[model samples]
Target: MSIPTTAFLALALQSQAAAPAPAVAPGTIAVEVAEDASAFDRLFTDAVTRALSDARFVPLPLESHSRYIARVTVTRTESGAVTAKAKEPPAMAALGQVFVPLPSGKSQIRGLVSTDLSVDILLRGGDTPVWSGRASTVQVEGSAADAPAAVATKLASALMRQFPRRDPVSVP
Candidate 1:
């Protein structure tokens, strides 16, 4: 059965600066991924490199030594038999559904996964990250071919929207 379903694209972004730091001036940045990166990770890195380039930062080849390095990691967490509770409509908020504890949901939804992306920018020899950001989203898991490209591209673009600029906000 072909089900026409929309991909959930609610992305949450959190970024922080390492102490009082200097603004990142446009310069060459080397993108690095885990040595044994999976297909999804490779695709995500490529997309992020493009995003960095679009932001006026030159992305150097992975092997090339550069003053700045953009180390990124991507992870997907999946769970079987998910239970999602329905939220009351805005008009029903005054009826106390929003405040009162709702009963357990009876239906079990499957195949949903949470994808997380984290990027850390650091100096060549620095042990601590000079800047960092994380983005996360949940969507139905697609086949190998479609998921990596679609999800990686969209996630990379969204995460890079605040590169090097958004002042660090304390995340609890």
Candidate 2:
């Protein structure tokens, strides 16, 4: 899926900021799966679950036995006003240009709201997170594809950079 370039940058930033992982095996994790009530929801859930599994933490079923619990999910939200790009001339283009309107009036593109995708991973339900990351940019409303899975993959990779930790202590 085509995501904003900034999303990849977020992946890098998160990798550096997160504490190192603990000495956990690939199959010792218990994943808290989200309920799928609709096709879209199912897609998102499946993507998240699949990505988590790909990270090789060995996610256990909700009722299965595991040492720790993890919750993975992605959310999209829009906010803030759009701004003009640099290097563009003024709204009038020229200082002496009369800002006259046509019979139908002229329309100029202004700032657009930002669309951000937040990917989070929680272990044992606490204020601190086992993994977390987000990717955001001024995505055109209809120009982007609905690919929660791709976003999850990026988030997972970033979080798993230090997988199978060499240290026994979990970084805070």
Candidate 3:
């Protein structure tokens, strides 16, 4: 209504429109695969790369070009048991009747396999680390053949969930 009030309102609206959006950190996340890592380890690294890419984080070039690094490791253990009964010996003619213990009807086979996967994400600038954390997952699968991949996928999903969403703010 009043001229001074109308002017103030217009100024307020302009200020709100001109306010800058929040700052987003620039740079990329680098992935480093250990040279001694097995084929499965490399696969895990690729899975991690895919997860980070899906999350919109830039994957930097090889270690030569980028400072940030992500490392992954995979380990597996398996145990199993087998039961076999001794065969009965042939009857001997010279000696009296030879007796042998009858085969036991109860027999069992059991096995256990475990896998441990560790993922480390490091956000770095030059030689200094801005953010760093490690995530690991363990899975036990039965005698199924496709269990390894399933376990790795589950582990990768867990790692992705643990990844931090927001970059650390730089303090002035």
Report per-prediction Cα RMSD to one decimal.
20.2, 16.7, 12.8
What does candidate 1's lDDT look like per residue over 1-172, in tens digits? Answer: 2333222221211223333576677688899888898877899999889988887888988687777899888878884445544344323223544554445444445476777778788887787887787777676555352377877777677777777754432211
Checking candidate 2 for backbone clashes, the offending pairs are 26-57, 82-111, 82-112, 83-111
Candidate with better TM-score, 1 vs 2: 1
lDDT of each: 0.70, 0.48, 0.57
Top TM-score hit: 1
Measured by C-alpha RMSD in angstroms, how accurate is candidate 2?
Answer: 16.7
TM-score of each: 0.64, 0.44, 0.50
Models sorted by lDDT, best on top: 1, 3, 2
Cα lDDT for residue 157, candidate 3: 60
lDDT of 3 by residue, 1-172 (tens): 9999999999999999998643324347777777787777777788777766665667876655554666666666664444433234544344356555444555445444555555555555444334333344333235333365565666666656555543221111
- What TM-score would you give candidate 1 relative to the actual structure? 0.64
**Per-residue lDDT for 108 in model 2?**
40
Overlapping backbone residue pairs in candidate 3 total: 0
Which predicted model would earn the best lDDT? 1
Model 2, residue 63: distance off in Å is 1.7
